[model samples]
Target: MSLLVTLAASTEELAPLLMPPLAFAGIAAAIFIALGFVVFSFRDVANRQGQGAGKSSDTHGSGH
Candidate 1:
């Protein structure tokens, strides 16, 4: 019932939760979610600009 025993037991119970594979999986999931957000935002902006259907600006300063 000492402090050391309690801490040790807590750590033992929590050790598997911080293992490397689980940590990597969490990081990968986070990155994928972030990428999805970025892509979604880009598509939204393109749609708002009326360029969502593959149209692009071609009006360069050619002075023709």
Candidate 2:
């Protein structure tokens, strides 16, 4: 009974420090995901630039 009481007391004191580590991990994960999306989008933009498809829309007005 005494051990349970002590353990519960420690847990209450440690909760604030514990939650911030989890929060930091979550924030780091979000930053990683954002960077991955930026790299992927830039890669695709570069691929589009190489395909010569960017001018098709500009010439569409002449067809009308």
Candidate 3:
């Protein structure tokens, strides 16, 4: 039938991926690793501030 022919023609016109399917997973993993490094870099940030590195002690108040 003509309908079967049209369906077969449409199925053949599929789009191609810009990259392989596994490459997409690799890209996402790389992004997460980079973000993990960024977060790790700030690991001791709070401790640095508590050490009187830059902030003045009296900023919170003299009551302590």
Candidate closest to the true structure, highest lDDT:
3
**Which stretches in model 3 have alpha-carbon errors above 4 Å?**
1-12, 53-55, 58-61
Candidate 1: which stretches are off by over 4 Å?
Answer: 1-19, 48-64
Clashes of each: 0, 0, 0
TM-scores, all models, native as reference: 0.41, 0.42, 0.64
Give candidate 2's TM-score.
Answer: 0.42
Candidate 2 per-residue lDDT, tens place, 1-64, comes to 9999897778454344656677989999999999999887777776777566657756677553
lDDT of 1 at 9: 69
Write candidate 1's Cα lDDT for 1-64 as tens digits. 6998887767444345556787899999999999999887787675567763333444543433
- Evaluated against the true structure, the overall lDDT of model 1 is 0.71
Best by TM-score: 3
Least accurate 10 contiguous residues by lDDT in model 2? 11-20
Question: Which sections of candidate 2 miss by over 4 Å?
Answer: 1-19, 45-64
Error of 3 at 3 (Å): 8.8
| Whole-model lDDT per candidate | 0.71, 0.76, 0.86
